[model samples]
Target: MAMAMAKLWMYCLLVCLGMALNNVASAQGVNPFEPDGGRRREMVPAMFIFGDSLIDNGNNNDLPSFAKANYFPYGIDFNGGPTGRFSNGYTMVDEIAELLGLPLIPAYSEASGDQVLHGVNYASAAAGILDITGRNFVGRIPFDQQIQNFQTTLDQLADNLGAIEAAEALGKCIFFVGMGSNDYLNNYLMPNFPTRNQYDGQQYADLLVQKYNQQLRTLYNLGARKFVLAGLGRMGCIPSILAQSTAGSCSEEVNQLVLPFNANVKTMMNSLNANLPGARFIYVDIAHLFEDIVANARTYGFSVVNRGCCGIGRNRGQITCLPFQTPCENRDEYVFWDAFHPTEKVNIIMARKAFNGDPSIVYPINIQQLANL
Candidate 1:
C-alpha cells in the first residue's frame, strides 16, 4: 500500500512539472514580435512612409503646430539630437532602412537640400485617414494634404532623376502606412466630442474603417503597389486610456471598437487583393503584437508591464512627457515611451513583427513573403 501511494505522488509531481515546462515553451515559441527567420535581403530599393505620429520621423513638429517632436529630449537618444522622430531613438522607418541597406529617409518638412533622394516621410503627428480627424488635434496635417506633399516630393525627385527613372524608383519602393490611432484616441474619445457619449462603439469603428478604405484606395491609385498597412495597437491598454478608465484595467468598451476596426481593415485588404492588379497589401497587426508583449512581459524580460516610463499624473496624458521629465532607467522593461507613444525598444519589437510573415500579426504577407510576390 505504501509503495502504491509513493508511485501515485511521483506521477502527480511529474505531471505538474511537465505542464510548467510546456507553458514556458509556449511562451517562448509564440512571441509574435520576435524577428523573422529571413535574412535582410534588398527586396525593396526604397520605402515611402505615410500616416501619423506612430511612424512620423518629425514632420509635424517642423510645421507650425502643437503636435511636434522637434525639440529637446524627444530625440536625445537618437543620434544624440532631435531628428523629428517621436521616440528617444530610431523608429520603424529607420529600422526598415537598416534592414534594406539604405540611409534613413528624410522627413518631407526637412530642408529640400537635406531631403533624401530615395525616400521621404509624409507622416504628421496628428494626421489620420480622414481630413476631419486632423482638425481634432492641434497642428496636425490632413491626409489629403499629406498626399499633396508626397506629390510635390515626387515631382522634385522626377526633376532630379528623369520622370521614367523616378517612376522606376517608386515602383521598386515599398510604402508603409501607420495611422488611425490618433483619430480614435484623440478625436472620438475626447470628452467634448459627441462620439464619446453618443455613438455605439462598433458603429464608430465602422465609420473609421470606412474612411481608412477610401484613403488606401487613393494611395493605390497613386502607383503604390507594395504596401504595409499597420492597424491600431492595443489602445485600450495604453497608459493614457488606463488613466482615463474608472478601473485601472483596459477599457473593454474601447477594445470592442478596435476589434471591428481591425476586422474591416482585413476585409479591405482582401478586397484590394482580389480586385486590384499587382496589389500586394500587407496588414501588420500592431494591436495583437502589443497585447502579446503586455500579457507575457516576463518572456520579453520586462518587469513592469503597465505605466509609462514618463511621469504619471492628472495631466500625464497631455502636459507631461517633456524633455525634463523623468525617464525610466531601463526603457526595455516599459512598454510606453510617453503617455501616448511607444519607447524605442518597444518599436524595435514591433518592427520585428512587421518583418515576420505571421498572418495574425502581418496579413497578405511579411517582408520575406512580399519578396516572392
Candidate 2:
C-alpha cells in the first residue's frame, strides 16, 4: 500500500509539472499541447466545417433541399460516387482534411456520439449567411439552423468524451466558415423578392456582414477559437454571370456589387481578432486567386476559363450540368466543372494554396498554420 501511494504521488507531481509548463508556454504566446488534447497524430485534432455548396460534402442529402448534388457526375471523380460534394471529387474541406491527416468527416446528420469526436461537417448545399438566402430551394438548412445543429453536436461531444475532454479537444480544432455565396446568387440576385429594392448592393452586403458577425460570435461562444472565414470570390466571373453578358466578358457591374461584401468580411475578421480574446481568424481571398487563374489560364494549364466543362448554354453557365450530361474530355483544362462549381483538379489547387500560400491568398496565416494554432 505504501508503494502504491508513493507511485500515485509521483504521477501527481509529474502532471502538475506538465500543467505549469503548458501555462508558461501559453503566457509566452505559444500554443503548448494539453495532456489530453495533444496526443493526436494530426496537426489538428479535428476540423468542424460550416458552409454551403462549396464544402457541402453530403450533409444536404436528407435535408429535402432541391440544392442537393448526391447524384452521378457530381462525385464521379470522388470515392463512393456522388458523396454529395459539389465538386467532381473532394471539396475544399476534404482536401484540407487530408492535409491535416484526418479522414473525411461525416456529415452532421450521419454522425453519432463517438463518430463526432473527430469532427462533424455542418455545411449544406444552397445554405448561406442569410436564413432566407436559399429559401427558393425548398428545405435548405439555413445558417441559423446549422449553428443549432452545431450546438447539438457540442452536446453529443460532451456526452461522448465528458465535458472537459470534449471542450479541450474543440479548443485545439479548426472552425471553417465558407458560406455567403448563395446570399448573392440565390437571394440578392433572385427577382422573386423585393431584396433588390429594399437595399442597394452595398447596403445588402453590409446587412449580410452584420448577420455574419453575429453568427461567428455565436460560434465562438460555442467553443470555436480558430476560425477560417472564406471571403466571396468574383461572382460575375462565373459562367452563369458571363452568359448574361452579351460581350461574354465578366459583368463588372455585378463584380463591383459583390466587392463590398468581401471587404466587409475582411474588416469583420480584423474586428473579431481585436474583440475576441484568444481567437484567431484567417481570411481567404478567393477573388484574387480566381482572377489570377482566369488571367493566366494557359500558364495554369487551364485551356478554358470562361466556360464550364459540362453545361448547355453559352459558356455552359446558363444552367447547371444536368444528369448524365457528358463532361469535357479534358477536365483539368477547365477552370469550372459545372456552371456553379469548380472541377476536382481546381479544388485540389485551391486547397494546396490555402494550406500554404502567401498572404495574398490566405491572409494572416495559412490553413496549415491555423491548424497548428
Candidate number with greatest TM-score: 2
Model 2's alpha-carbon lDDT is: 0.85
Writing each residue's lDDT as its tens digit, candidate 2 over 88-132 gives 788888888888877788898788755676678999988988888
TM-score of each: 0.83, 0.88
Candidate No. with top lDDT: 2
Candidate 1 worst ten-residue window by lDDT: 30-39
Off by over 4 Å in 2: 1-39
What tens-digit string does per-residue lDDT give for candidate 1 at 79-167? 85876678878787678677665578787878374254547788888887667675655677777778788888777767766677666
Screening candidate 2 with a backbone cut-off below 3 angstroms (N, C-alpha, C), the clashing residue pairs are none
* Number of colliding residue pairs in model 1: 2
State the C-alpha lDDT per candidate: 0.73, 0.85
